[model samples]
Target: MRHPRLCAFLAWLYGNEATTGRILQQNQIIFPAIFWPAPENAPLDPDAVLGTFQSAPATSLPEVFELPGQTYLRNLQKISPGLWNGRTYCMKAFDLTEGRPTLTCSSGHFFDALVSCDLLEFELLSAFGEVMPEEEAFPEFCERLTLRGTLHALGNPLHHACGRSAAIGISTLIIFPAEGVYHVLLRSCGSRLAYLDKFFHTVPSLMMQPMLADERMEYSVRHNVYREYLEEVFGAVEGEMPYTPAQYHDIYADPAIQYLQNREAAGSARLLLSGVAMDLLKLRPEICTLLLIDDPDWWLTHRQRLRPVTMVDSRCGSAANLLERSPATPLYAIKLSPELELPTGLLCPERFTPPGAAALCLGLNQVRKLLLYI
Candidate 1:
């Protein structure tokens, strides 16, 4: 197998596997175009890029989120006959008076019960249920959810080298029954932080510090550039660094931020449309879309309570462009991007992954996937 770091880097630089493959192929390396494994007892066609979009059936379904007249969850659950498709469920809600959190299951219990049962039964699987007011269940599942799940739902990803199972963390689908809205909520577990730390460090060392580093690097570069301009104009008589408005170039021009600003400035719109043909050729056979989260800190913080999730550099607005390159291309992105239109039935957290919650929060299945990546 190719070096995971190199594979990760190529994914970052090219913004998608199709482009990554093209970049490698253009260099004349006969690399495996497919990363995810195809199912066994199948064709030995190495030319095929395995993925769900191609392998899975496409129902031209009208995208009706919650069925009409399904105002209450009980009704929806009854008629839907396995709304979650049998995935486990848990509930979380806030205690306004106490103000921390109040999580429970439909059984009227808390964490202990959930842990004891090894399964959770909740109201509907929605963030509003986690954050809003609700009646308590008997022996509630728990106020704050902390545990793990099996990787079956995670869409197993096998790292080719070791033939090991990599954990994918957890991902939740947020279905807004009333508003007819649906989204995905992603989270990871505590055990995966060390792996994530290693992932972040693989990128430019400075990327590990978090989003604030981008700001600080900009400030430092701006100051340095201004100083250079001043010295050129006034003959190098340096004492304390002097400042002058005229000495400044656009912050975007600072060499330190050149790569970052250039990538963003290119605009996600252009990237999504630039390589339609290439994207089609490289589609995978299992997962429909793959978004690599570049920031370990962001992934750790924002993914709490959702599942074992990672946040790649959302600044890569190119994801939207990459997705657009192929009609059936899977969409991927970090925390934020203009191009990342998550497939129907995925939820994205609007806030940061809270500190110290990394381990307890990741998805059980995602953990299983990372074991493969590592």
Candidate 2:
């Protein structure tokens, strides 16, 4: 007997019949409250968790307010001025300048603060950032800022963004009175297409499906199938999208319907990768060595602050062309098989084990070299 989940997934994939936005809406999305266990063999104090906030930036003494069931910190409280120390949560009357009631955080050392205590949570910290509609071009009312080119050019050259990094310009919050508890969602001003790849790169690490109950296999299978189906239909390099896939995903995943559910009850699931790559990780939070590319024939010639590395071709969609066209620097590629390895010894050599594949892969190198000549 075949697992019904696998059968359904195959059917959905073949037909390309997807889990619609309507179905995602039907499921409840919630992020479980994650907690870092106090180090083992040591006495952990709950009071200590509160004390950690001693240096928390507080304009005045803590003023506790009982609004709904949730507690809020009133006043301009600097829970942690530094991003690395811990997250500082505060509550303020809604302000037009602050943008919408959204979730905001940072990546890098700044995001490290969130782990220390969940007490430091944002509550009504103003809501005034941009609200991008799926069909609309970015609103003219605000300025568009993106790390698209510049981010990949950095010393670390992050491959993907997730976690606090997603909070760079947008906000994350639980949309009230809409659905289940702790419905975490993002509200960015413009198309966040560049950041999704970075965010989901961490998905394999999250062990997302196993965390769920056995009975929910039907829902789970359909969901993963939907994402993969979208990739096949929309991710292809050459095609005329009858409907823009990016736009569809955005609108379908809107807060009106979608929410992020936490896997663990106590909140220790480290699956939040919404903001890691494209400056969004500060909102949420890479692996791989940095490789530099040197293609002078590329666009935008600047001083050699960072030299670029060359890629030998083996057609698994090298990032070389993409990186060369962008502001991202220190570009690199990992060979999937011998067919994909560049001529560089610095990269993994095991890829060349299959001799025949290696020969076919060399053809890709020839094509790239020809492009340089032309």
Candidate 3:
């Protein structure tokens, strides 16, 4: 990597308690622990969990910092050529009031401004002095940038004032429940970007994007999650741009998509929103959720067919076909006991991406309550 010092500093920042404390001080969590559950302990309806998406004009990094930030990104991408600059749905504002979370977003790109925020943070800290320890320097960084106080005051971590595109990350934990046990699927990502070679929730943790010209379709988290599941888990090829209405119809008509929808409608499966939080390291917001399939029959019948595409392969055409791709990343099934407590050894907490670990914890908490009444 071009910025070895910055990279090494980040390595030290991961899982750092100082970072966690800073986030908590702003009333933001690094994990999926902020659910607005119903009175009966059931997850709120998916629609109720999210309020609405308000359209806004795109924002960019402050002009003063744009050049240096983009220069840093260019150097970093030299070693990670697989990085793609694609269109994104940038978060302008986020609000949760009365148990309903709403968002304001605008058009953005991967290279437009989101990825540079971390570099800017690092640069600001380095300006203080090279000799200071990061733990001590971080608070000063926040004070000078005022991002933490601004986020706390506005109640929006991705507030436009931060001068970041703030692209949203959508992460879901897929769980398959049998007789009395829950099987959680996990993915070990091999990409060089965020969360490199770390265990993330299977079913693909994706960024929010505008897949088509339809505003409603592009903004729907349900549609985004379902489409990602098909592409990553089943290796379904996404249609190219200038898409026709018929293309979308075919996408939703895929057997896997239909099955998931039917199971949810039949009350045998659920797609619940656990909560949303910012990754302390990058300041990126993640929408954490759970995809719980209560029926074991689905798993027993399709276990062999679950061919997950790796993060690297998904970005580039490294393999001729889905079957030619590398074997699926390690999958672990933590067999839950009658008490629903997760067993050790099968999974390691430190290996998980922060959002993934949080989703698993929150998902299991909700499932424990859900199964009690089932």
Per-model root-mean-square deviation over C-alphas? 24.7, 25.2, 7.7
Ranking 1 against 3 by TM-score, winner: 3
TM-scores for all candidates? 0.17, 0.18, 0.73
* Candidate 3 C-alpha lDDT tens digits along 68-132: 66676886688777666766776666565554454566667777554454554545345434544
| 243-348 per-residue lDDT for model 2 (tens digits) | 2545435434633112222212223221111111111111121100000122221112221221342222344242223333433323222232323223333211
Q: Best to worst by TM-score, what's the order?
A: 3, 2, 1
Clashing pairs in 3: none
TM-score of 1: 0.17
What C-alpha lDDT does candidate 3 achieve relative to the native structure? Answer: 0.57
Alpha-carbon lDDT, every model? 0.22, 0.21, 0.57
- lDDT per residue for candidate 1 within 158-177, as digits (tens), equals 11101111111111111111
What lDDT is reached at residue 134 by model 2? 29
